[model samples]
Target: MTDFTGSMGYCEFQIPFFIEGVRVETSQMLVGTEYHEEAEKIDRETAIVMPLTKTKLQDKKEDLNFVREDIQTSFVQEFDFPECKATLSLFGRADKVVRKKETLIVSDDKHVSNPRRYDVMSEPYVGQLLQVLAYLNSKYYLGESFGGWKEIPCSTKMYQINIVDSKTRSIYKTYEEIITEEHAELFLDYTSKFIKKCLELDSLDHHNSKPKCKACGYFSDCSHALK
Candidate 1:
């Protein structure tokens, strides 16, 4: 197995969060130009969607940290759903790892037309979430540094905020922090791209309707509305 935490630093700005494919972005989060310098550039490029086709690692073994405590690795494989992709992160003290033979539960709704929603918040495995994130980080930064369409989840519980140039790295708040949905969905670069994607999908359906089929959600908003 590859040990990613040998001597390198922690992931810069990514937090632990999951994606439900569709994302949303607004103009309210356009601060901290320097903090999001790298991420902003990455946003323009096309993402090479990651394919974690492999199974999640099941580790029941315990690791003794420097704090003089035996911490057990209690998580087997992650669950895969049909409708939406889930990224789970579990916290708490567990004795050992546990892997459910059955696929973990996923959201039931397949027609998610909205953004800023996650399927794993209700129920998810922490181990699976970490594994998937590590995989994505490896693919995005370790091997070939680039962007892609693979949905990513991050937790910014432990992060180091730094900026190389002035105004490049400024701290941005979330909606909850700013008391508004617009701020909660701030564009910190990494998430900005996803939010932009969601906007594109929304705009396309609103403007150009290639087919006059009844399945279109924006049929009412389309130019050629059927009476």
Candidate 2:
């Protein structure tokens, strides 16, 4: 969903690269990768894991009843939906899940060179918002299957951490109404159209933004890239 909303042009330009399993690593990508690796390592080292038994679930619920925050790492959810006569699997891994007082706050952390580019008061980038929404929506639909905490309310959050200055900004939103099956179906429709376009390699549909083309990894090799 992030790729489809954020970088459809780039994805289309690099279709051949993706098919051949070739990745173009940029300096920015390397830096972001390193930051996530270090963060994940630290989180894993400090995280406490407990078996999800009935007793444990109750204990955890009681523990979270108070105003407390639990940092859950690599929170993953997956679901399968029928789309266009085929089953489409949607999966997302949230960076952190905070069980705070009857609310499940799904947080995604983004490491960026400059944090000033993002504004916390405004809505997050379309792709980022959708990515977080997908996680929360799936949790809502799957109910208590994964954990018994689905009864709690769900919210979305984004942490934009600055790599250079070590600064952070957070954007929070509660999208209860948008988490319905109707919205999920709309998202699936967009996904289905995106997949079909990818399969057809629709050259005419490429983004014509020169700034985006210049920043794309496949700019040099993409014939449709805007000059």
Candidate 3:
């Protein structure tokens, strides 16, 4: 129930505004973009174990090179829609880049307490899927921009690894979700819709009330706060 317009993360879409003489920072006019800083805080033990585990995994898998070593740790991508004179910005980093035969695989590694494959159609993983899609799509645009662009078949996937523990050290799962042309189109549609909605909301004097308002910092001052 959190307000999307105010939430902050790796990818954010906001509309800046002024309300009752106060300037709102998250308005559509200014979509706040953030990165690595907001990443989940892992415990000391997990942080220590992560690299060892990753190295072991890498040693076991051939022809796999963590993208961390090949490219910048993080990057930002943006596209402007000339059709409507609107712009979309995205920022994220892929976990791994692997070359298998002729196909390139762009993958994301996720560590979860109870690892399991997620349905691409579900909401919980939409943001994650969008991230991978952005990575794959960005490569195409980048190739075009840089030239020497040899079109190659590539795919995006994710690996949901179980948390590392004594009982799970030998057990983990890899999940791969295909990012197709349809998903890319869907992302564009949603992004455009989100931008339009954010701008529309920015022009309003009030927002609809929801349960999450109780925890929002602006609750007391919000005109739409429930009584």
Model 3 weakest lDDT span, ten residues long: 28-37
Candidate lDDT values, in order: 0.24, 0.48, 0.39
Model 2, position 111, has a per-residue lDDT of 50
All candidates in order of lDDT, best leading: 2, 3, 1
The TM-score-based order of candidates, best leading, equals 2, 3, 1
Stretches of candidate 3 exceeding 4 Å from the true structure: 1-66, 69-84, 111-124, 140-173, 201-227
Q: Where in model 2 is the C-alpha error above 4 Å?
A: 1-16, 54-84, 139-186, 201-204
**lDDT (tens digit, per residue) of candidate 1 on 71-126:** 21222223343434433222222111111232211100111222224323442222
User: Which lDDT tens digits does candidate 3 get at residues 52-171?
Assistant: 233332242323343232332222334454444555444444444554533456654433333443333233355455555555555422222334222233333333322222224323
Candidate 1: segments with Cα more than 4 A from true spot:
1-21, 32-35, 38-141, 144-158, 161-227
RMSD (Å) of each candidate, 1 decimal: 18.7, 6.6, 10.1
| Candidate No. with top lDDT | 2
Clashes of 3: 7
How many Å off is the CA of 95 in candidate 3?
2.0
Error of 3 at 225 (Å): 8.1
The total number of steric clashes, by the backbone 3 Å criterion, in model 1 comes to 25
In model 3, what lDDT does residue 89 have?
A: 49
Candidate 3 residue pairs that clash: 14-27, 14-28, 15-26, 15-27, 15-28, 16-27, 16-28
Give TM per candidate: 0.18, 0.62, 0.45
